[model samples]
Target: MSTERDRDPAGRARNARPRDALGRPLPYGAVGEERAPEGVVRPPDRALAEAQELLDAGRPFHAHEVLEDAWKSAPESERQLWRGLAQLAVGLTHAARGNSRGAATLLERGAGNIAPYAAEPPHGIGVAALRTWARGLASAAAAGRALDLRPPRLRA
Candidate 1:
């Protein structure tokens, strides 16, 4: 069986941790170009971009679907990272629907899962803020705050 990680844009790394925009520890490795396992192929960047765009547009559920498709195509080892992002997307979807607690849980898992990868995340996203955001999600859950999955919304 071929895994998608083999075809990741970042290529196959032996236990490499993915990072965020700023450079923090996430739960997975960067997606890159490498030979896929037989019939499997790498997830397209277009899907990831679409998901991100959805998040930007306040459409987390739609974003989740976009990323979910990519995630499923990703390798097993990398799946957690993708799943984490997907869950975070779902959490954000819930948050948009006014479900803070649900959002908190999913976001928390997403952040946790992303931790290992954050150590060496891919390009674009901010690593420090991502980690901080993840931590903030857990804290918000603890304090029962209406957690917002939206990234860097507090900034102006």
Candidate 2:
């Protein structure tokens, strides 16, 4: 057997997925195949812009799809930020569909995931707004208050 340091330690571990060049977990290429593409990120800027556009259009589910691939291509540490944004987008989608409870749950999970960025969030979805929305939902839930799940009005 190869030494722990010399061998692929992660390969021997159970439930361990392979990583890409940037150490980000790549999605399974197929049902049971796990492989990274020859390239890391296809088009980070385009992906980000599309995601932003979806968000601006109040289409969180669509935005989530736009960002998933880019997030997978990012480094491991960056994944959380992207994942959090995706989750938040998902929550927003559910809210738009009139699923307040579902939205609250997803938003809470997203806030938890992005807690590290609470002080300084990324460009599009920052931690501050996420936290605020999460807290509002939590309070509404606890107090049996009705919530308006509409997205905030964007200033022109």
Instruction: Judging by lDDT against the true structure, name the best candidate.
Output: 2
Per residue, candidate 2 scores C-alpha lDDT tens digits across 31-135 of 332332322464655666666666676566666665566678867877887777667667777666667777778777876777787665555445676667766
- Which 10 successive residues of model 2 have the least lDDT summed? 30-39
- Model 2 clash pairs are none
Off by over 4 Å in 2: 1-45, 120-125, 138-144, 150-156
What local lDDT does model 2 show for residue 106?
79
Q: Lowest summed-lDDT stretch of 10 residues in model 1?
A: 32-41
TM-score leader: 1
In terms of lDDT, model 2 sits at 0.59
Query: What is the TM-score of each predicted model, taking all chains together?
Result: 0.61, 0.59
